[model samples]
Target: MFRKWESPEAVFHLLKACSKGMPCDITGIDDYRMIDEKRGIQWPLPDGHPIEPLSERRLFEDGQFYTPDQRARFVFEAPRPLPEPTTSAYPLTLLTGRGTSSQWHTQTRTGKSYVLRKLHPNVPYVEVSPKDAAELGIRANEWVIVRSQRGQVKARVFVSHVVQPGQVFMPMHDAATNQLTFAAFDPYSRQPSYKACAVRIEPAPVGRSNHSALPALNLFIASLGE
Candidate 1:
């Protein structure tokens, strides 16, 4: 599986090149230490000497990519039809993913250590558009229930322009949010579009006692009047 932090493009390109009978050059060092030292090496370096431990060189520097037409092929694009497209029933779309930090699919394990959780406690909150918040009577940092075709979960709403009119974003770090997200996978890549799935959000039900705010004296006076 590709890592959220690592780029899969290099591996994909190298594999494709090998399939086409393009010979790859290796200088005969195959030890773990060599691999670690060559981690920053670049391909096609003259005399096999990489300019940097990590190659910062961009491909196609010579404006050629081994194609006769010198143009990259737009072979195919898997149709994504936009997850939860219409949302006529749901009325919103939810996209969830990760940030540069955070280490896993859920925070249950990460939250155990005080220092780690404190480093990013409930960070990357759910984002909703200002218009949606206004309609639902929710303020930033207030709670909202995000319901997808799969299920629902409560998250703190963070109203901002970055969130589109009908789209909301939540980081996948929280299992609680995942419970309400689509688990569909891309047929070809086997990658799930954890982003851009259909969903709906509303102000969660507030559970507070209506009479709990009254003073004891007020209750007694009301009882006497009754």
Candidate 2:
């Protein structure tokens, strides 16, 4: 079995040199010590530099960039079609984003907080427009199966006007949410196109429960801490 390091500082010291040439100047162990003294300073501070007062500091104020021309560059290209298009089988567009300000990605740590979990929905849910839910015979809080070309998962139905007809919204905190996302990426930036995908929603089988194990486990752990 793999052994854990004595402490995080031990690991940081081993990888300190790797930070060289990065945008941030946290290239040395001493720079990290400044965190306690300066209450955290923005990068680009070389050794022997004095800490600036804690305040917002923007970079590239002179409109200079790291490119060879020392100027910013822009790329323009013709619009490309979505990797997955809506079809008769998958007639709705699905979008995913942050569930709440208190919850972060995956909710591995944020989910542990009782206050944060209480502020947001405890279970995974998809927001569907009233028109779509009514047409599909889906009721609020009923379990629904959302399917895409890639995969599908069960989520509770939340009939809300926040989403428009022919579209649905799912929070990104659930692991199952990404099972349906397309792997297609932008050619220029190589960023995955996670915002758009074709999906279809149907009511889950009778007597099916919408509760997820992870959230329930997290709540149980939080209760133990109380």
Candidate 3:
């Protein structure tokens, strides 16, 4: 189906088929030479557009809009209820995000590099606040099962003050995180959310600890990644 999609000719035709006029019209960029000479063509460059530096073609130069009233439209949406609110059964809020610079989402490609693998923790782990850890009898580097209404994942625990007492964080890079994430989508954008969910953590059984296998977190340098 995508036979020649990589060719410039295919891209030009595809852009024309879905062009939205001024906002993203780029049917003018029909040739590879045009692209090479232009360095890069800013969007809305319809066919026969005058030659100018790509950045020089500014939008709304007259401070106006195409609307009948010549004004921009703003979208407002009422806040929706939390997808998975915390309850007595699941008291802690779970936050999932990037954990290291060496890894990308799901670590699909970055995980294969030997040097990158050595730069971050090899096993999946969840961050728990010291207060919650003490209350739940969770020690650092201990295996704990993070359970949500959707599912659960076994993660090594890293108790620190980074997270609030009632909240925990897991790296989105781990493939297993999706197993416990609640599937919820926004009404307007129809985008799925992965930021928050309600879950509870409990230490795994006694034998779950591997004294010599699992490496303890470098809590002193808590700046894992952005």
Best by TM-score: 2
lDDT of 2 at 65: 80
Return the lDDT, model 1, position 100: 22
TM-scores for every predicted model: 0.55, 0.81, 0.72
Per residue, candidate 1 scores C-alpha lDDT tens digits across 157-204 of 666677788777887887666677667787656887667777777777
lDDT of each: 0.61, 0.77, 0.78
In candidate 1, how many Å is residue 15 off?
22
lDDT of 1 at 191: 86
What RMSD does model 2 have?
5.4
List, residue by residue over 24-80, the lDDT tens digit for candidate 3. 777677676777877877767777777665347677776788788989777798887
What lDDT is reached at residue 93 by model 1? 79
Query: Between candidates 2 and 3, which one is better according to TM-score?
Result: 2
Scanning candidate 3 in windows of ten residues, the lowest lDDT window is: 212-221
Of the candidates numbered 1 and 3, which has the greater TM-score value? 3
